[model samples]
Target: MTPAFPDPHPTTSTIAEVAICEVGPRDGLQVEDQIIATEDKITFIERLANAGLDTVEATSFVSPKWVPQLADSAEVFAGVRHLKRVHLPVLVPNERGLDRALAAGVESIAVFVSATESFARNNLNTGWQEALAAAERVTSVAQTSGLHVRGYVSMCFGDPWEGRVPIDDVLSVARRLFAAGCSEVSLGDTIGVASAGHVRELLGRFTAEERTRLALHAHDTYGQALANVLAGLDSGIRIFDSAAGGLGGCPFAGSATGNLATEDLVWMLEGMGIRTGVELPSLVEASSWMADLLGRASPSSVVRALSA
Candidate 1:
């Protein structure tokens, strides 16, 4: 059974509510050298749902040649399709990925494009325009198939090759994604180079209405992910993406690090009296279990502190 979580947008709340999308099963594990078994991935996702994460990125449907770790996307989706109340969104890079996700009965899918030309070529082997066009095609097909589509604009802060990305470039990709029928666009700090000021500036470009359609995906390479997240929250962003046990980095991006830890985010949010509906202890337990399975201590401070 899917664990119950509060409404993502509460109709009445004194404190602002935030929605966390757990990307452990997909983004968190994609770059890991040790491939976790398919059944273990399914179990980890189930644990996340039970801990009250409303959205869980289950797996990606990319080619095995590209991401051999997630080659079992279909099997993972099949195993967890029975879970209710939680949105299981899988990443689909192109039409072929979308087809695989659809055949596996995926209800929601995420498409990715980079903000910088160099990273775009490195990750997708194409320029920004070509990647955007592909995203448009995939988004259209996914929407027509009755799947909720989320778009990811990577390197929104700074690219490894391109030092600082222009805000206009980031907005351009986001605009196209939104125009192409994506319900939400996640701005990703793929290299974890963004500071609080950078986050505020990027969000400042969006109108209040447009801001509602945005999500923040931060990495903790410089230990600034939480601070950047606070900046995003101050700018009225209520949705953020995080990984369990701080377990992911972009394989293609050198110097990249794990994503902002879900447990750490929850710890901070709950302390501020912001309701995320996640049981912190349960989340720590989940991450701790995952860390043990992966043969390491969790990278999240909250998980380590609590376990100690």
Candidate 2:
């Protein structure tokens, strides 16, 4: 039998509450071979909202030349009406991306910078210092425009070019992002090479208060996403980024899958009696719909088993 859905109002405490930022539409759809209808994208977001996810990374405002998948971002934004309580954040890689997102009336935006110099040079085509400078400029403009900006630190676990990222390097980048006015810095395992032990060792450098300002953005390429998440939770990190149906991959990193599936994360959290406030069955249903629309299989085992 399928596991019972989590209670709507459970009076529980020991289990920590985590903010699951669903990146299904933006990260998930961008890597697909087929283009989902604009109305379908809106339907996906609506279903996510109905599943009790308060913060959803709705879309990216990149140029159509780069990612034609999210070229319909403006139209999708106009169509998907979110609850006042829900936060619909979009990815804005630079000033131009921010401009488009602003025009679309996006309330929040995410800016990213790589931790290692090689990754920065290869992925962003800019040096580490230049990328930081660029992010500073974008963050300033976003703040002035009354948009809440979040920063992402890619290759926090390990760089494909350079191996074993130092703890000081990760902390320095995160501190810089925090100082640059980004509210939260999401540490990304861009290649999905992190182990639970590695997570504990790396996160040990930050204190409880410092950890609160961090978010975990992990890939499931090596199938260690859940274990890393549990380690992050132990370290006091409460926010995580996940894609629905596991529909994402780093165009820059070969063999890297998308961030962990939101469905799988919800299933694990609910099973552990952790309160995410996300309705798993409804959320999984949305993932199933999106997977069917894309004509591809889902990357989430929980979605497959539950839907079966």
**Candidate of highest TM-score:** 1
Worst 10 residues of 1 by lDDT: 1-10
Residues 149-207 of candidate 1 have per-residue lDDT tens digits of: 99999999999898999999999999999999999999999999999998999999999
The sequence of per-residue lDDT tens digits that candidate 2 reaches over residues 249-290 is 887777678779998888777767788898788888888888
Those runs of model 1 whose alpha carbons end farther than 4 Å from true positions after fitting are 1-14
lDDT score of residue 20 within candidate 1: 94
